[model samples]
Target: MAQTLQEILLAPNRRPKVVEDVTKLVDSEVSDKSGVSGLAVKSGYALIKKINSSFVSDAVDSMLDNFVGRMEPYYASYKASGTGSFTEHLTANSSDVADALLGVTDDRAAGSRRDSVKKVYAKLRPQAKKHVEEALPRLGALVEEHAAAVNTG
Candidate 1:
């Protein structure tokens, strides 16, 4: 059987790199935004960062496993289909994928002790689905790259 996405991504040696890559992905996604909603995302992200220098990385590290778990079903479907790019598969199912990803953050935000973080999340939540959908291509590519690394290594 093929290794699960969680197993592949959360391996002890690979976890840190995965977290780093995820953090970069978040940075890229946030930085790529524009317009009013984009402004909101950027500002909310900036607020989170201002609260803690390592917040993004720490959040990525903490959320990586949940993120991978949320994505596993889509990954499995993509691998099983053996057709189209993972990016295409992800984009094709953008709503579910975005929801699944957001679910992780929603739960985290609910339990967060930092009211500032929760407030930022709430502010960003309204537009988050669109932003996350936009990110699916790069996110898929990142997952595919990691899957390839495991296959080749």
Candidate 2:
């Protein structure tokens, strides 16, 4: 049977490598995009790498937790006030949201950041999800192989 992600992640020895591989995969997927949205993806990749390198435990989970927590309120407020999809809401308020999230000061920089966020929400979100899902089986296999090698040697 194929091991679930949580099953692999729960193994103390395997968790860090799994997290590293997943984060790297996500970063790669985001970085692989083209056009103006690539700017946001690159920024996001940098932030993810920074978060991942900052701790000994599961940094990706921590980042996700924080991101979700922060976003929930924004999403709720948007939902309460608007009728469109979240992407549409985000695109309409990208500059304000980007400024709030990133603390960008320069108007030009904020505009760029807003564009990046809009691109991510509007276009790249599904691709990012699919990329991660597609990578999981390969990552699990690598983990199994590593475990076997470690056990044998």
Candidate 3:
């Protein structure tokens, strides 16, 4: 049987490292942003971090399971296809992949008690898809790296 992303990534031995890598991926994505919207993203991210020092890591940890769940179908498809990198598969299905990931955040934001956090999320949500789409390649690479690690280790 093929290993699920949840099984590989959410395993107790691997979850922390996956979370840390995801946090770094997010940080890099945010940092690499440019232009007016980029500034907003960077600033909003900074504000959120200031609001809670561990917010990024905490969010990643909390959302990882859902994120992996959302990606499971796509991952399964990639495995079945047996051609092209996961990066390419994610890029080819960028809209669906990005939307699936964002859905997790949207749900989280909707249930958030902190008005400030909600406000920040609201302001950033408009441009989020483009940013997320741009990050898909890196996100794909990150997933592939972890999956490969498990295969080899």
Candidate 4:
């Protein structure tokens, strides 16, 4: 089992340093936009939300990897005893991260502060689009690297 909420909240690994900077940058961009009286406000909230989503996705991936690692030894022991197939167990549970992340994107996108962040993305939709355009590639690269590591390891 995992730690309690209090422990998780206090855990050092849960903290990602870059989220604040990203939020601040997005808020500042929103503040510079014209005709939007509270673009900054929305941008701030949206940025937080976007970063939160990203963090959640990253956390899910890490968690599933950890879970699988822990399960492997137990699975091997069970398989050696002729209790079950570790491969079957692994495959059945392997969907944890992928399914969770896809659900987060699909269900949470509508709520990602993604669009809202863009709206305040400096009062210019283009600016927001540019940020997202750049961000997606970076995130995609990270995912690719992470997947490669998992596959090879």
Clashing residue pairs for model 3: none
The alpha-carbon root-mean-square deviation between model 1 and the true structure, to one decimal in Å, is 1.1
Best by TM-score: 3
User: Model 2 compared with the native: what TM-score?
Assistant: 0.37
lDDT of 3 by residue, 1-153 (tens): 227788778989999999999999999999999999999999999999999989999999999999999999998899899999999999999999989999999999999999999999999999999999999999899988988989888
Per-model TM values vs. the true structure: 0.96, 0.37, 0.97, 0.26
> lDDT score, residue 74, model 1?
92
For each candidate in the order shown, give its overall lDDT on alpha carbons. 0.91, 0.47, 0.94, 0.40
Worst 10 residues of 3 by lDDT: 1-10
Worst 10 residues of 1 by lDDT: 1-10
Q: After superposition, how far is residue 13 of candidate 2 from its true place, in Å?
A: 1.4
Candidate 4 residue-wise lDDT, 1-153, digit = tens: 222222222234532322333334444544545445345445455565565756533533444334334433434443466643433443444444234334333433445455644343335333333333333333333323333334454
Clashes of each: 0, 0, 0, 1
Better of 2 and 3 by TM-score: 3
lDDT for 153 in candidate 3 is 85
Clash-forming residue pairs, model 2: none
Error of 1 at 115 (Å): 0.7
